[model samples]
Target chain A: MPHRITSARKLMQGNEACVHGALYAGCRFFGGYPITPSTEIAEGMARLLPKCGGHFIQMEDEIASMASIIGASLTGTKSMTATSGPGFSLMQENIGYAYITEVPVVVVNVQRGGPSTGLPTKIAQADTMQARYGTHGDYQAITVAPASVRECFEQTVKAFNFAERFRTPVTMLTDEVLGHMREMITIPESGELEVVDREKPDVPHEWYHHFEITPTLVSPMASMGDGYRYHVTGLVHDQDGFPTANPNEIKAKMDKLRNKIVRFADEVTQLDVEMVDDAGIVVFAYGTTARAARQAVHMAREKRIRAGLIRPITIWPFPDDQLRELLAHVRRVLVVELNQGQLIHEIERVAPKTCKVAGLTRYDGEVLNPVEIFKRILEVK
Target chain B: MMADPIQSSNVTYDYLRVKKRFPNVWCAGCGIGTVMGSIIRAIDKMGYSKDEVALVSGIGCSSRLPVYCDFNTLHTTHGRAIAFATGVKLAKPSLKVIVVTGDGDGLAIGGNHFIHACRRNIDITTVLINNQIYGMTGGQCSPTTPHDSFAATAPYGNMEKGFDPTTLAKAAGASYVARGTVYHVQQLDKLIYGGLNKKGFAMVEAFSNCHTYYGRLNKEGDAVAMLKLMKEHAMPVKAAKVLPPEKLEGKFLTGVLWDVEMPEYCELYQNLIDSFQEKDKE
Candidate 1:
C-alpha cells in the first residue's frame, strides 16, 4: 500500500515517536520522573514541550507526577506522564484517584522487567496485569499496547483520544525493546490525526454538576478557572461531585465509573488479526512479543500449516468479543508473552471451549524469537 | 470588604458551599473548623472571586475543608495535595491556588512533596493545619507530634522530635513562611492572607487542635483546654526575639517567621517557553 505522508519521514526511536505523538494529540502539560527505558519519553517531552508552548515538570517522584497530571487536567489541559514499572507502582494510588474522580490523563509505562526493580533496562510485559489491577479499586481500565515504532506513535494518539472521550486515565504499554529500538517511521502532520478534547459542560454554571450522569455515562468536565466552581473528590461522590455515603448514590456512582468504560468496550478495543479466518492454530500476543508471533505465523503458513496471529492494540478491555468470534473454529491457541504467563488467562477465559489455550512464556529478560514461537506452535498440535 | 472575622460572621458565609449538609465532619470544638474559618476569612478579605481560586487538599480532617468552600476544590489522595496544586498553578498561573493539608498528610506521608513544593518556589499558598496528630485516623503520631506525646501509634509516647514547619519551609526556599495558632484566629487570618498575597511558595503553619484525638490521648483535656494551651504557649516573633532562651523554651513563635523575594516557578517556566518559542520563530 502506498502511504500518504504529509510530514517528513525520519528514523526515530519508539520513545521519540511517542513524544511526537503526544504533541500531535494536543498534550500541553507533562509531569514525570526519570526512570530507565522510559526516561527518553520524559527527556523528549522536556526538550520539545516548551517549544510547543506547553509545560513539562520533573516531579519529585512518580506519585507526584501522577498527581500533577490530574491537577493539570482539571485546569483543562491535556496532561501525561511517562515511567517504568517501579514508578508505575508508585503511581497506582493517584491513578486510582484519577479513576474515581474521572479525570482525563495519560500514563505511558515503557515496560522494564519488574517484581520490584527486577531489570531496569530489560524487556518484560509483566506489567500487563498490573496496568489493570495495580490501583486498589473496582473501576475498569483502558490500556493500549504498541508493538512497533510506528504503532507507538499511533497508539499514543489513540490513548489520549480514549482518555479524553472516556474521561478516565489511559495507560500506554510499550516495552524496553520498542521504547529504545530505532525504526523508520512517517510522522503524522498536524491536522492529519483525529484529536479529541474533553467535553465541557454546556449548561449554566449554576446547574453544572461535575459528575452529572447523562445517557453517555461520561460527564462534561469544566476547567478550574472556567467559572464552574465544583468539587472533585476521591470519595464516593454524587452527580454534583460532593462526597456521599447514601447506599443508592454509592452504587450509582460505582456503576457510572464502570459502565462508562465497560459499555463502550467494543469502541475501545483495537485489534490486528491476520489470517485467522480458517487457521486451525493461532498465537495471541501483544506489545513487542507480537512481532515474533507475526513472524512465526508466516513461518507456519509457509510450511503449509494453518496458523494465524491475533494482537490486541487495546490490552485492557481485552478484545474478548473479537477473540471469541475469531477463535470459534480454531482448535488450539498459543499465547506468546515476555512474562511468565499473563494474557493467557484472559485468552483462556474467552477462547472457545473446544480450543486448547496455552502460554509460551519467557521471563529471563530476553525477547522471544520466531523459531522458538514456531516450535511452540508445532508442539500445540 | 476586608472585614474582621470576629466582627463579621455574615461575610464569610458567602464562601461556604451552602447547598451541602451543615454540621461538618469535624468533632465539636475541633480547631480544624477554626482554621477553615480563618482561611475563608482570608480569601474573603482578599476579595478574590470564588471562580478564580482553586483549593486542593490531601486526605485528612483539614483536607475536607475544601469540599465545604465555594471554589474549585480537589480532594486528592493522601499526601499529594501540594503536588496536585503545583500542577494546577503551573497549568493556569492566573488562578490563585491554595492547598489545605494536615500534619500527617502534609509533613509525613507527603513530606517530600511539601518540601519540593517549597523548593520550587511556585505561586501557591499552603495552609498546614498542624494538630500534631492524625485526627481523622484517630490519634496517631504525625511529623509534628511532640516528643514523648501519647498517640495510638506512639502509645508508649513518641520518641522523635517534631518538625518546626515554618523553619522547614524557610530552609526549603519558600518565599514566605508563617506560624499561627487557631486560638489566635485573627492573627491566623492575617498570616494566611500574607501567604495569599505572596508571589512564590508560601507556607502558613496554623497550629490547630485535634482535641478529639491528640487532646484525649495525651489527657490534655477537651478542645477548650487545648485552645487555652495554644494561647498560653504562643509568643509573637517580635517578643520572642527579645526574650531569653529559657523564657521561650516551651513557647512557639507566632506571626511571620521568614519572608523573602524569589522567582516564582510558573513565571520562570513561561519565560523559558517564550524565549525558546521566540528563537524557534526566528
Candidate 2:
C-alpha cells in the first residue's frame, strides 16, 4: 500500500525521509527497538521494508538492536538501527564493538532532551559528545547532523556511503525537531544518487583474510556464509581477523583504524557555508539550532550586520579544515546549538586563532528562533 | 576418506584456525575444553562446509569458543551473542548460526535478549555453558550459581536460588530445549547435535564446572572430582519421573526436556515479503 504513494511533492517528516533515504541507499536490514522521536524510523522501516524486499526487526533492547545490525552488516547486508537518548546510552557498549570490529552500519540517533530521559519528546542536541565518545575504546566515529528535511534524506544516503567507504559505523545524529519536523522533500529517483556497497574479497579462499590491508586501508569484507571462513573479534587483530596480543600488531591495527577516518577527512567532511566570505560575525550552528541560524543570518544581512551561517553537516569528523577556511575573513563566530556548549568547544579548538568564537546555546528545551539568534548575532558584533 | 580435505586434517585443526590459537587461553582441567571439543565435533559431523556456519559468542570464557574456531566467527560484546546471531540468521537464513554464551553472560545481563530470541523462535542454536560462577572474571556468583554455594563474591555462601536455564528457555518458547553435563560428554554431544539440527530456536544448557573457581571455593576438589559428583547426581528426566519426589532433590535433570515445531522467524518474514510483493503486483 505504501508503494502506491508515488507523489513526489508530499510533505514527508524528517524521520520518514531518513527511512526513504535508507531504502534509496540500498539498506536491506533494520534491527531497531522503538524509542521516542526515533520510533517513527522503526515504524517506517517495519511498514515499508518488507514491501521493498528488505528486513525489519524490532529487537529486544538497544544493545541487541546494535548487535543485530552489526551482525547483519557482517553478512554483506547494508544494515542500520535507530534510537533516541536512553536507548542510545544502552547501545554504547555494543557500539564500541562495532567500532573495534570495523563493521559498516548506519545508526540513527534522534536526539531528545536528556541527562537521563530528561524530556522524551522535547528537542535537544546534548548528546553531541555522547555520540562521539559514548562508546568505550579507541576508535574514531563518523557522525552526520541533518538540519533540513532534505538533508535528512541526502545526509542519510551519505551516511550509508561513508559507512561502507570506511567500514565503520556512521551516525545520522538528528534531533527531535528535525525528526518530527514535516516539510516537502524531493527524493531522487533510483540511480539518481550514488550508492556504495562494501567491497568483497576477490582473492582465492586460501589467500583471503577478512581485514586484508591494501592501499585503500578499508579492507574488503567477506560475508559469514562465504567460503572465506574468516574470523571477526572485538579484540584487536592482525590482517587475518584473529585476535592478537602482540603490542606491535595491535598498534598497527589501531593506527590503521584511526588513520582510515583521519585520512578520509577531506572526502567525508560536509558543511553548509553561506556569506562567510566577508562577514564580520559568522554563526555556526547544527541541527535544530541551525534552522534559526539561517534565518537570523538572513535577518542580520537585512540590517547590514554582516552575518553568515556555517552549519556542520558532518558533526563527528569535525569540519576543522572547512571551518578554518570559511572563517578566515570573518571576525566573530557565533555558534548556536540546542545544547548549552557542546559544539562550541569543538569550533574553538579548530577555528583559526584570529576569529572571536562565541556560543548562543539554548538548553531549556525550547527552539532557538531567528529572533534569539539575531540577538546573539548583534551582541557578538 | 584421506583424500578428502576435511578428513585429511585432524578434528581440532579441521574445525579451528591454526595450532597457534592453542593451547587455548584456558586453565588445566577446564570443562570448557570438553564443551568446545563437543561443539567442534558436532560441526564436523554436520559437514555443512564450515563456510556456511557462523559461530558467534559474547564476552566470557565460553564466548571465547568462536575465537579458536575456523568458521566465520563473531566474538561480540558481553551477553548479546544471541542477538548478534539473530542478525546473522535473519540476514542469511541458509547459514547455520550458533551462539556460544556462558550462564552469567546469557541469563544475567543479556537475559532480555536471550528470552526475546527464544520468543521470536529464530533459527539459531544457543549452547549456554553454565559453570554456576563467573569463571573469566574470577568466580563471582552467577545467575545459575547453586543456592548456598561459595563463590568469590558470595564468600559466606550464596542466599539466592540458581536458575534452571533449560526451564527458562522452554518457558520462553524456544522450540528445542535440553540440558547436558560435561560429565556426560556423549550425551552433551548428541544434545548439541540435535540442537544444531533443530529448525527453530534451540538451547542446550550444558552444566560445565569451573574447577578453579566454583570447585575450589565449594570444596568440590579438582575438575575430576567435580565431574564425578555431577555424574553421580545427574538423573535423566525420564528416570527422575519414576523416582520419589523427595529423592529428586538437588539432582540435575538431563535430556531433551522440550521440543516442538513452530513457524520459524525468518521463513515467516519471507512470506511477509512475498505477500507484500503480491499486493504490489495488483
Candidate 3:
C-alpha cells in the first residue's frame, strides 16, 4: 500500500515529496516509464493516483510517456512524467512537440550520469545544458532545480504552476543524491500555496482559435470534448491551429511561441541569494551542488574571506538579468557543478568581462563537497 | 445492421470542418480521401455528436484526416498517435478516441506502441491506412511494403515481407480486428463502424491507394488501376476458409478476422480506484 501523508510534517525522500507536491498541485494524471533514480515517483503515482480519481499509466517507453502526458494535459488534466538521463534523452523529440504545440505538462528528470547509460545510480548535473537546449528548435524552457527534500515538494508545485501559466513543459531538474536522500519536510496543507491553472477560452465555439495571439501572447486553451472542435497539429500553424505554409503566418506563429516565455522572463526566473551585498566573491550554483555551495559560503564567511552564494531555483531563461546585476561588483564568480564546465559557459556569457568567471567542476560520477567548493573559492579569490 | 449512411441521399457534411482548409493536401484521386469519407459516414451512422469524438493522427498523407474533420482533432508527432490517443482515452474515458495512422507511421516507427496498446486492451479505435509505401516522404519503403515491390529506398526491389496487420493485432491481444479496402467502400464503412463500437482495443486496417508514389513507381496506372488491383485480389474471410491453399495463393482476405471480449484497461483501473476508495470509507 502507498503511504498517504495525513499530517502536515513528515520525513520523506525527495522523490516521495515530489509525488505529494504533484498531488497537492492538482496533477491528476501521470504517464511514465520506470527509470533508475526516478522510479519511486512513478511507483508512488501508480499507487496513489487512482484513489484520488486520477489515472496512472506505465507507457511502453519514455517517448510514449512524454506523448501520453501531453495527450492527458490536452484533456484539461494536469499531467506529468518522471525519468532520468537515458529516458530524458529519448523524450527530446516529443518534448519539442510539446513546446511547439504549447501544451502544459511537467517533466521531472532525476539527474543521473552520462551520454549513453553512463551512471544510473550515481549523480551528475550533466543534463543541465540538455534541459535548456536538448530539443532541436529555438524555444525557451522553464526549468527548476531543487536542493532539498522540502524544496522538492515546493519546486514541483512551482514547476506545475509555471507550466500551466506559461502553457509549456517545465523541467524539474533533481539529481540522484536529492532524489533518494531523506530529509524532514513540512508538507503544505491545502490552499497553503498558490496553484495556477491554464486559462480557458471563453469565446463561442466557432470563434475559438487554439493559438490566438492575445496581448499576453498566451492564448486560452480548450480541452477535448468541450465542444470547441479545434485542430491541433505539430506543424507550423496559423492561429486556427491548422497547418500553414504562408511565410508571414509562420513567422507570427514562431514569434507568438517565443515571445510568450521571453516577455515574462522575470516571472519565470527564481533565485536564492545569500550574503552577496558586501562580498567580493560569489558562488553561482544550482541543484545539489548549490547545497554544498551554501555550506561553503558560510564556511568562507566564518574565515572572514567575504564569500556569498547565488543559487537559482529556476535555472532557465538562464537568470541572465539577475546574474548580470549580481556579478557587476563582485571580482570573482565561481561556477560550481558536477559536470566539466557546462553551466560555467552560461555564467561567463552573462558575467562582465572584468568579473573573472571560473568553474569548479567534477565529472567522475561523484558529488561535489562543500570543502572542495570552499577550496576552489579560496583559489579563485 | 446499422442503417447505411453511405447510401443515404442527404449525406451530412456536419462532421467536416470544410472551412478549415479548402481542398486538402491529398493528391487528386488519392484513396485516402475515400477512406476519410467512409470514416465520416461511419461516425454519422453511429449518431455520435462531433463533440464526443477526438480524431488523432501522426505525420503522413493519411494522417491528415483529422485536420479537415470537425472533431476534437490532434495531429501529433511522426509516429506517436497511438501513444497520444492512449492518454486522451485514459484521462477521459467518456470521450470516444480514434487514431488514424498510415503504414510507416503505425507499423514502422510506432510498432512498439501499436502492439503494447493492443496488449493493454485499452478502449481505442485505430484506423490503419496501409498504402504499402511512405507516400508523404516521396515513396520510401515502409514496413508494410510487399516483398519484391519497388520503392524509393528499394530501387531494385523490397527484400522484406510485409506485415499482415489484422493477424498482428489479433496476436497482440486486440479484441477486434478487421481488414477493408477503399475499393470496397460500404464494407470499409461497416468495418470501421464495428471497430469503433467495440469496447476494447480495435484495429481496422484500410487498404488505401497512393497513386502518386506507389502507383507511378510500379507502373500501376492511376488510382483506378491500384484500386482495381485490390478488387481483383481481395477475397472475404469466409471465401478463403473453404478455398484450397493453392487456389487462394496470391489473394488477400478481407472482412472481420478476429473479435473477442476482454476487460478494458481504463475500466479495470477505475475498479482499482473504487476498491481503494471503498476501503477508505470503511
Candidate 4:
C-alpha cells in the first residue's frame, strides 16, 4: 500500500504561521495591543501584511483593539485581534457584542499566566473555561486549540473559515510555548488553500434580512454603505438587527445562535485519537498540553498501561457525545491540562460515573511536562 | 451697504439632523458644542454628502455626538470608537469616517488606539475634543488634564504631566495635525476643513472648556468669564514671535501644526488588490 503525500510546505513559527494563515484566508485588517508571548503575532502581521496590502493597527488598549477588529469586520473585511490574559479579559464586552451582532471576526488568545497579568511571558491554559464563558451572556463560541506550531497555521486558517462560515467570532486559543516556539511550516502557495467567505444573501440588498436565518441559520452580512438599510445592535435583536424585548424573540435568536453550531457538531468539532480502539485507559488533553499528553501516553504504553490519548482540536461543543462513546468501554479516563482541573470537569460530565476519572492539573506558569503526566497516569491506574 | 459675505455654495447646513436640537449634553459654557459646531460647519463648507459620512464614537459624553448626527452613526463601547470607525472606513473607503472623542475617551482610555490609528494612517478625520478633565465622569482627572489641575481624583492637584495632543499626533505619524480652541471658532472650522481635505489620518484637537467640572474645580470662573479670559489670553503662533513668553503666558497657540501627504492604508490595500488582479490577468 502506498501512503498519500501532502503538499503542505513548511518554514514558519506558530505566530508567523498565524499571520500567513490570516492573509491566506483573506483577513485584511488586524487590530491588536502588544502583550508578551502574543506580541509576535502582531509584530509579524505588521511586517508581512504591508506586502500583501492588509492593514495592521496596534491599538491604545486591548479593549479598543478588540472593538476595532469587530468594526473592521462589519465593513466586510476579515479582521482579528491577538492578546494575552488581561487583554483577553478586557475584550469580553466587545466579544459579547460580536456574539450578539453575529459579526464574523477572529480573536487569537495566546494564553499566558493570569488572573491579572500573573506572568507576562510564562505559559498557562487557565483561560480554557474563560474562552467559553468570559463574555457576559448565554452564547456559544467556536474555540480551536493547536498542539503544534504547524497546527497553529492550519488551525488559524480553520478558525477564520469557521468565523466566516458561522458568521460569529472564533477564538484561536494558543498558549505561550506554541506562540513563541519557532517551527518549520511548509508554506503552501496562495492557490493551494481552501479559504471560506461568509455566505451572502442571494436576494437583492433591500430584500436582504441581516439576521434572518435560512435553513442553515446563518445569514449573509451586508456592509454599511452598500445601500442595505439594516440596524446592528448589542441587544438581543430580531432578524433585522433591531432590539426586541420579547422573551420569545430573544430566546429564538439566542437559541439559533447557540444551537446552529451544536446541531452541526460533527462539522465543527475535530479531535485526534491515538491508540483508543483497543486501550483500556484514555488520556484526554488539548492545546500545547496535548503534546505532553501524547508523549505521556507513549510512556504509559511502554509500561504496559494500554493507555490511549484523545486531543480535541475544537474545545467547544465539548466533544461530549464523541467522548461519551469513547469512554463507555474504557476502564479509566485521565484528563491532563496546565490549568488546575478545569477541562477535567467537562470530561467527567460526559464520561459515565462507573468509569473512574481523574485530572493531572498544574498552574505554576509552566508547561505540564510529559514526565509529570506519566507519573500521574501511573498513579491513577 | 456691504454685500453679505459670500457664503460658499458648498457651505450648506441642510442635512445635520441633530443640529437643530440645542442644549446639548456638553456642560454650560463647555467648548465641546462650539467644536462640534465648527466640525458641522467645516463639513458643510467641504460639500461632503452627509449620507457618505459615518460618525463613530466610544463611551463618553462626547461619544454621544454620533447619536445626534443623521448620517450612519455608531455609539460604541468606551474608548473603542476609533477601532469601530476604522472598521467602518475600511469597509467603505468612500465613506467619510469622522471620530468625535474627548480627552478621556480618545487619550486616557482610548490612547492606545489613538497612536495606532495614526501609525496606520488610515484615511479618516478624527476630532479629539480635549476638554482636559473627564467631564462626563463628574470631573475625574484625565490623561490630558494639565499638570497641577484640580479634579475629584486629583484633590491635591494632578502631579502627572498632560499630553500635548498635537505633538503626540505628529509624533505618532498622523498625516495632518492641527490645534484649535472653542473660542477660536472660525480658526477651528478652517482647521477641521483642512483636516477633512487631507488624504490620510488627520486629527484636530479642540481645546474645549468644561465649565462645569474642570472650571468650577480650577477656579477658572464662570462660563462667560472663562470665554472672556480665553479671548484675552490666547495668542496666535505668529503673534507669539514679537510677544515675549510672559506676554503670551498660559495661552495656547492655535493653527495647523503639521500637514503632509503619505500613502494611506486603504489605498495601499486597493493597490494590492489591483496588482493581484493584474497578475492573475497576466
Which prediction has the highest lDDT against the true structure? 3
Q: How far is candidate 2 from the true structure (C-alpha RMSD, Å)?
A: 2.2
* DockQ of candidate model 4: 0.29
lDDT of 2 by residue, B1-282 (tens): 258674575575677756647668887988887898888888878877888889999888999888888788888888888899998899888899999999999999889989999999999999999999999999999999989999999999999999989889999999999999999998999999999989999999989879999989999999999999999899999999889989988798999999999999999999999998887789
Model 2 clash pairs are: none
Query: What lDDT tens digits, residue by residue, belong to model 1 across residues B79-169?
Result: 9999999999998999999999998999999999999999999999999999999888878889998899999999898999999888899
Worst 10 residues of 1 chain B by lDDT: B3-12
In model 3 chain B, the worst 10-residue window by lDDT is B3-12
The sequence of per-residue lDDT tens digits that candidate 3 reaches over residues B202-253 is 9999998988888988898799999899999999999999998998988999
Clashes of each: 0, 0, 0, 10
The order of the candidates by TM-score, greatest first, is 3, 1, 2, 4
Q: Which ten residues in a row have the lowest lDDT in candidate 3 chain A?
A: A1-10
- DockQ for each numbered candidate: 0.86, 0.83, 0.86, 0.29
Question: What is candidate 1's fraction of native contacts?
Answer: 0.91
TM agreement with the true structure for every prediction? 0.97, 0.97, 0.98, 0.79
When 2 and 4 are scored with lDDT, the better candidate is 2
For model 2 chain A, give the 10-residue run with minimal summed lDDT.
Answer: A1-10
Off by over 4 Å in 1: A1-7, B1-8
Which residue pairs collide in model 3, if any? none
- Which 10 consecutive positions of candidate 2 chain B have the poorest summed lDDT? B1-10
